[model samples]
Target: MATLPVLGGKVFLTDSGGAKHLVKAGCDIFMSTGVTHRLTEILGFAAGFALGFEGKDATHPGQRIKVSEMGTALLGQAVAKPVGSGKGTGLSVIIRKRKNWDDIAWRFTRQDGS
Candidate 1:
């Protein structure tokens, strides 16, 4: 089983192959692998569902799955791949600031110099 930590808004990546990577805080929202995993914290932990790779072509160094804050799901079929190889895999959820109307307006104005 794989495991990650959810502490202080920071993300920790741990694959089944004993590989560990600490993702910087405020970078990725959260992630899960294709195995029964855990999201540990200082006080306790939560279990995560396995994103099974039963019918996948690439196993280890699995496909990179990036989920945006807008609920948009992006698969790394033609883009970035994972770190290692195996039947185990994980997901990366991006934490992004939501754009507001004012932000959009400012961007538009800046682009048009109006």
Candidate 2:
């Protein structure tokens, strides 16, 4: 199977025993619209896979809800900012590991006062 070059050598096995590389954290999948709904959708898919939200049981609804809400809020913030205000027009989705989700979310929440 093809693997992303940025993943380097980190690999893991799926339930089906297929080998896959772990996505690099803080990697930016860029697009024309920075933080727009469309961009968020792309980012969400990457986040979901990196965070193990794919083909998983819904036993952890709370964590899922938090991530969803955080994404929404981030989208809103991106939309609210003016396009040419030095923030640039490109959007980058930061992909992180499942283990670091809580700490990352907390930092974002505290930083944004949300």
Candidate 3:
């Protein structure tokens, strides 16, 4: 059995020659010794329930999975600003101001802008 580092309170594990698995907090893994183990020990074999290996591939134990190229492009399109909008003059400005001011106007305006 292969084990990965705990990150964000979740553990990722993979078999020697098979699919990867994500083990969340409080989940139990049963060992071959007929004893139960938590996320700290060996994980039992899981088959037929593959979480697709597209954007979730990690090369090293603690390496983070990054947004795939297609995912990044799609996200950029989804949040793209309209043409002719002035730079740093919209919600970004409001957010910057709200960090220093707790006034009712700033709070309400930030909510509306968000």
C-alpha lDDT of all candidate models, in order: 0.37, 0.40, 0.35
Which prediction has more favorable TM-score, 1 or 3? 3
Candidate 1 ranges with C-alpha deviation above 4 Å: 1-78, 83-88, 94-106, 110-114
Candidate 3, residue 16: the lDDT equals 28
Least accurate stretch of 10 residues (summed lDDT) in model 2?
64-73
- Show model 3 residue runs off by greater than 4 Å: 8-10, 28-114
Each candidate's TM vs. the true structure? 0.15, 0.17, 0.16
> Which one wins on TM-score?
2
Model 2, span 33-99: residue lDDT tens:
3246466667766765666533322444334322221222354364443333354432333433566
- Candidate 1: residue 87 Cα off by (Å): 7.7
- List RMSD in Å for every model shown: 19.8, 18.9, 21.2
**Candidate 2 ranges beyond 4 A from true positions:** 1-35, 53-114
Q: How does candidate 1 fare on TM-score?
A: 0.15
Candidate structures ordered by lDDT, highest first: 2, 1, 3
